[model samples]
Target: MLRRSWHHVTRAASGIRWYVHELMGDTAYAKYVARHETLHPGVEPLTERAFWRQRTDEAERAPVARCC
Candidate 1:
């Protein structure tokens, strides 16, 4: 009984962690890597540093809705 309750708690905690990561954009690179792997099985995904640099460059080139 106690073990089952503990399992439920752990699963809920994991869900919360995933939610927070999604909310903060912390999982963007991970999602990109997964998609890249699926779409281009033989190619390598960009490194975190390179990913951020590319994203920044693209944003600068095509400035979208922003407040600042």
Candidate 2:
């Protein structure tokens, strides 16, 4: 019972961590890489730094008004 309870606690913590990372866009590159691999198997995906720069540039070019 103790081991099972510990396992549940660890799983819950992992889920919460994943949720926070996703909320903060920390998983964007990982998701991008997965999609890129599926869509363009032969091509190399962009580096994380390049990916963020490109994303930032695109956002800047097309500004969106948000109540942030």
- Give a tens-digit lDDT track for model 1, residues 1-68: 99999999999999999899999889889999999999999998999999989988987899578798
Per-model clash counts, in order, read: 0, 0
| TM-score list, all predictions | 0.61, 0.72
Model 2 sits at a Cα RMSD from the real structure of: 2.7
Give the least accurate 10-residue stretch of model 1, judged by summed lDDT. 59-68
Q: In model 2, where is the ten-residue run with the lowest total lDDT?
A: 56-65
Computed on alpha carbons, the lDDT of every model, listed in order, comes to 0.93, 0.97
**Model 2 agreement with the true structure over 1-68: per-residue lDDT tens digits:** 99999999999999999999999999899999999999999999999999999999998999678999
Q: Tell me the spans in candidate 2 whose CA falls farther than 4 Å from its real position.
A: 1-5, 66-68
User: What TM-score does model 2 achieve against the real structure?
Assistant: 0.72
17 Cα displacement, candidate 1 (Å): 3.6
lDDT of 2 at 11: 100
